[model samples]
Every structure is written in structure tokens, then in C-alpha cells.
Target chain A: MEGFETIIFEKKGQLALITLNRPRVLNIYNVRMRDELYEVLSAIESDSDVHVAIIRGAGEKAFCAGADLSEFLSAPAPTFARHVRWHRDVWGLFLNLPQPVIGALHGYVFGSGIEMAMCCDIRIASEDAVFGLPEVALGFIPAAGATQTVPRAVGPGHALDLLLTGRRVGAQEALAMRLVNRVVPRNDLQVEAEKLAEKIAGYDQGAVRKLKQAVSRGLDLPVGSHP
Target chain B: MNSIVKLECDRGLAVIRLEQDPPGPGLADRLAAICDELNYNTDIRAAVITGSGPVFCGDAATAHGAQAAFSLSTPVASLNCPVIAAINGDAIGIGLELALACDIRIAAGMAHFSLPEIEGGLIPFDGATQRLPRLVGRARAIELMLTGEVITADEALRIGLVSRVVPAEDVLNVALEMGREMAGKASWALRYCKEAVYKGLDRTLAQGLQLEGDLYFLLHTTEDRVEGVKSFKEKRKPEFKGK
Candidate 1:
């Protein structure tokens, strides 16, 4: 109903635009962002009018640099924190969205950022976008869905390389890894992401949802279980 | 400890070499012991298994009566930390199975790979039957086995059997460097990442997601995780205690 401190949620003509609003810190994912995203994603999932969603960041510097490490490590109580994490379940929310999601990515997309982008059905990265999963360098694995989502996106070889070495890749390299579906000029990222979102939003909602389910659920089935 | 298997430990890395030219009997026990050593030696965060001379582990890997005991895959795959197979030469038959059990592989340019156990009227007794198909897909894995085709290092790389292919001399160094890089990071996280991939891949999608989520939550309880965050905030390299 009102504004969120960490995200901008707007809907127009069956399309939802969810912007990561903490531009001051390159939209590093924080607890507030997690809560706001849970709400936004939940809203999009339930609302029949919202046909598709476009997620982007509000800054020139980054789509999302990574998770806010300070907030992530400081916990009230182990049990409570773990419970809260499961309750928010931001990555699960992203993956389970009924409407197809598009990631309009730019700048530093690292760690949780990479995981988030991979959750999207489609991703369009700006030329200036730089991607990485530097969790290994910091002494932790990517606690987000990266270990699973990334391999699904880039295959195990490239995924293992990026995860193990904590190396950063440019937008071109990310595209080559198939991490992002399309690359565009920095200025054109929003336009392109919106164009794709608009096109999907215009399609017959039932058919569009079925197509997403067919492709994603089809991948999950065991080899012989289908054919 | 034995002449058949030479092990060297240094700053968070265990380098195990197959020194036995014609790998003698009891090689499996020696390897299994090394795996146990790697598991208990908290100091050693990663390992590289390579051949000392030309061949990685020459023949006799799954040789009839001793085949069950000689499976190279079980011990290597059981290691807690990330394992890199520095395939210095031909990794044929069960040797290739050894390489497949590793989490990553850096092969020598002169190296060759094949699953020619069929010629001996035997199917690969080690983890090859399952691991090969997973790595290169069922079709290619079958093709390689059915044809008994020996693929070059470049071909192995193309098929995703090995991650990198370097000159014969550089293979060990490359694999060692990769192992060292992984060792320097938070060791438990490395284990967690490996577990998520290896364990999650086999389950149904929902089960895989659940497993990944479980591991992700479990990391929050580690001190290294807190240190990782604090150091990031401080703008200094995190001192991972796991090392």
C-alpha cells in the first residue's frame, strides 16, 4: 500500500516493476530488502492482473553488489535467525513466482546478485554489468541459491570455475557463460527489459504461465519419467 | 606412507601421487587411508591426485578378484575437500574412473582417456558407469565405452570431462594452484558447495531445492561465516579459520 524502505514496487497495465532502491550502497541485499522482496514477490504471485515482473536496481553503480554481509552475519539467536531466513525465503520466492520474471541487470552483480539473476526466467544485462560470485574469497560459500541456480544456468564446469576461483566476469563473459540471455548498451537496459516484460504481459496469461511451467517443470522431471 | 602412494602436505593442501608404475595390490587401502587422513587432517583443505611418471594408475584397477577392493573412485570421492585430478598421462579403464571421481580435473596436454575395460570382457567396476554418464551425458558416455575410443585431452575438455588442459609439465602446477586457491577460502563452505551440487543433482527438483536450502541455513551457524561478513565490512581479506 505504502512505500518500502528498500524496494520500489509499482504496477502498470498487467506489468510489475520491482526496483532495488538502496542505491547508496549499490543495492546490497539486506534484511529490509529481503522482507520487502518477499512481500513484493508474494504480491505478484497472488495478483491475477500482474502478468509479468521486471526487477532492476535504482543506481548507476550496480544492480546489486551482493548481500549486505554485515547484516547477514550478525544474528539475534541461531534458531531464530535460521527460522527467519526460512520464513523470508527470498530465493525460493524468486524461483516459485508464477509470472515469468526478467532481470534487467547492470553494474556489479556479485554473489547473491548472480543467484538472483539466475532465478529469473530471462536476464538482460547492460554492457557495463560485471558479474561474480566472490563468496569463496570472503571465506563462505554462496548461501543463496547460486550453487544450484548457477550450474543450471551456466552448466557445472563454468559454474564450478566461477564459484571456486571467485573470479569476476564482464557482461560479455557472463553472456558467453549463458548466465545472461541478452546484452545491451547500459542506457538501453531498462528499455529492453521493459520491452520483453511488456511483450510477455500482453500474451494470453494462461498460455504464458503454461509455457513457463512446461519448460521449468520439464527440466525437473527424471530422464525416463516423461518420454 | 607407502611407496605405491606418495603423499605430501603443505599449507592446507594434500598432494597424493600414484607412484607405483604397475599399481601393486592393496592400492585401494592405501588410497582409502589417505582419504581418511585428508578427512581428519583439518589443516589440509584440498587435495590433488596425480601420477608421478607417465600413466596415472596403470591397468589392474578392476582386475577380477581384487576389482571390488581396488575401486579408485570410492576413496577419492569420499574426500571431504575439493579434489582435483591432475591427469598427467593416459587415464584409461579404471584410471579414468579415478579422474571422474574428482570434483575438478586439469589434464596434461599429452593425456588420453578411455573406458576400454570392455575389451577385457568387463564393465568398468569403479564409479565410471555412473559418473561418466553424469559428466558427459548418457549418449557420449555410452559412445566412448561402446567404441572403446580413446579421446585426447582437448577432446576430454570438449566433452566436459576435464575443466582445463595444460602442457604435460603444467598439469600438476595448474591443479595444485586450483587446489590451493580453494584451500585458502572457507573450507567448510567449499565442502558445503560440493555437497549441494553432488547430492542435489540426483534428487528431484523439489528435493534438490530443499537440500540446497538446508545447507545454506547451516552455514549461518559457522564462525567463519561471521568472519567473512566482518572482514567484508572492514574492507580487508577475511581470515578464514578453516585454513
Candidate 2:
């Protein structure tokens, strides 16, 4: 496994585990982390040896607290635009990837973290995880695909409520809201996610991939117009 | 400025209103026709669809006689350009479905949304069942569809139902602005990307990748790619012809 400066990208058997490496700032996304994430995702996407991928953050503080606010504040307009595009492209890779990506979330999954989790096929969170999109409160809307993807995950009303108010919800609330698939104790988050990933990986990858595509694409087609 | 359809164009943005007076009739058909026509016209890059008066759209079952209203799925899926729904007022049932079909939706501060089909003793036969879950999630989607509850714009925005909430007068304007922004991008890239993204959703990863590869190959053969590259090299904006 290649050593990553901003992320811990390791291969365990057939699973590629990518951990957001920052703990002090709650693993907030900075330029280096963002670029490294893109690189790691690209590696996984092209690596036939890796059958599945799991993303989590180091430490118990947060999976991510969203974008690094200091960095965002210092960026210029053109830089910001590029950052936005990069954000989209990276998440697009996750969403469009053929293999499954499971997000192991805990602590604060706010702002861009929520957006990133929304891109994953399945999300398993620790009972301690808290989720929200507090971007609006900061005077910016979710520019990363949250505006487009969150509704697809939760529904218009719930998605809008979170986006508009930037309110945070705990793991139980998240599960009840169906924002995440399952919630377990903080210590069991990784183990449970890996178990789920292994179960998915044991199946015919082709079928899993197809099922994902069918649900994602079929819903967008005309009603009763499935081909 | 006809009572059925009205068009306003400014700065390359097209605002198409679905207008009908009191007791409006057959408005869905007219709106569908307008969408089809606008899609076919190469000159128009982006469009905002809204109602002419207090209603963003009345119940499609009422104004279009239920059976006559166009299927929300087909027309919206076929449109090549970005479409924004400016929900200036109430968007209930089929009206809400129509709004969801658009790529982006902006609602007025006073806008209200609901899925009343189940409460009315009829399952939403259109794309609502499929789209609502995809737009929100299965749990919340079920809650809304099962209960037929009406949510206000504030609630809608909080939950990520609509992108923005503006004054009733500004909904159309904001939607139009968004349309123009989308139109300013590489048109062919946007079109192919949209097609690929939507199409890929229904396929297996391998199938989706193949589809993406084919579309990507097709795009690479177009003049827009060359222009896009050239403009990037020149550090200037690319003027795309949609080809």
C-alpha cells in the first residue's frame, strides 16, 4: 500500500480502506486532503484487486467537520470555483465508480462531510455520529452535490429541512430519518461496516454493480418505462 | 402573453410560464408541448418553468383532467437542456411531481408542497413513487407519500427539497439565473454528462462504465472538445456550440 500524506489508504485483502487522516481539526477537507482523496479514489477505481472500499476518519472526534473553514476563507474566486469543480469531480468518481464504497461515519459529519457520505452507496455510522449540512448558516449553500444528492437520499422535505436550517441530527435521529443505513456503537462502527462490505464483496460484483445502476438509473426513467 | 403559455427571454435565459386563468384547463398538455418545443430549439440554452399567477401549478388531475396531462417522466427525461422549476405558489400532488422532474427547483417563500395521491385513495401513478425516494430517501419519501402532508418552503429548503427559497416575485428570476449559469458551460459536455449520469444509474457498474466510455468517445470526436481544450490552454472561456 502506498503511504498517503493526508489520508491513510490501505489494502486489506480485497477491501481498500481510506481513512481521512486529520484528527485535530476533525478531519476537515483541505486542499491536500482533497487532492489525496481524488488520487486514492482513482487508485481504487482502477484497481481490480480491490473489490470494495471503506472510508472513515481517524480519531473519535469526527469523520469530517466539512471543509477546512480557514482554507475556504482564504481562497480567491477562481480558486474557489476550481475547488468546487474539484469537489464535484471527486464525489462524482465515488458515485460513478463500479465498485461499492461504504462510508463509516462517526462524530461530526457536517457540511461537505454529509455531501461526501451522500455520494457513497451505503453509509454505516457509529451511534455517536452527528450529521448535518450547516453550510447555509455559514452564509453559503451546499455547493458540492448535496443540493442535488441529499434529496435523492432522504427526500425533499427532510433534505430541505437540514439544508435550510443547518440543523444537526444524532445517529439515532439520522437512522430514523434514514440518512444512514445503520448505526452501531462507536467501537463497532468499523467492524460492522467491514462485515457489511465483506458480505457485499462475497457476492457477484457484477450483480451488485448492476443492482446499484438499476436503482440509480431506473428511478430517473419515465414511470413504468423501464427497458 | 397568451393565457396558456407565455415566453420571456433576456440575456440568453428563457422563462416559460405555464399560464391558465381561473379554472385552468389542459395546462399540463400546453406546458409539455412548450417544453418539447423549447428542447428542440437550439437557440435556447436554459429555461425556467413556472406558473403565470398565484399557482405555480394547480393539481394536474384537476386542470388537465388527470388522463390528459402529459406524463411527468417522459418530457422531463427527454429535455436535453437544464430545466428549473420556479414554484411560486402551491405545488401539490402532480404539480409537485412536475417540479421534482426538473433538474433544479426554487420555491417561493409562500410555496407549499405535498404528495396527496395516497391520501386521495390513489397511489401516485406517475413517477412520484420512484422519484420521491430518489430525491429524498425511502423513509422520508414513504412518510410524505403515505401521510400526504404539506410542507412549507422553509421546511422544504431545510430538508433539501428545493435549492433556494426566495420571495414569490424572485423565484422565477432566481431559477432563470441558475439556468443561464448552466447554459454558460460546455453545452455538449453538459448534455452528454446528464445523459450518461442518468443512464448509468440504471445499469451495472460495468454497463454504466461502457455507456460512459461510449458517450465519452462520442464527445471526444466533437468540436466542443477541441474548443474546450483550446480555451483551457488559452485561459479564456470556451464558447460551445452544443455540437
Candidate 1 ranges beyond 4 A from true positions: A182-188, A225-227, B21-25, B57-69, B117-122
**Across residues A51-109, which tens digit of lDDT does each residue of candidate 1 receive?**
99999989889999998877765567656866776777777778888899999999999
Candidate 1 DockQ score? 0.47
- Interface RMS deviation of candidate 1: 2.2
Best by lDDT: 1
DockQ of each: 0.47, 0.09
Assess every candidate by TM-score.
0.88, 0.58
Model 1 residue B63 CA deviation (Å) reads 7.9
Best by TM-score: 1
Of candidate 2 chain B, the 10-residue stretch with the lowest lDDT total is: B21-30
Q: Label model 2 with its docking quality class.
A: incorrect
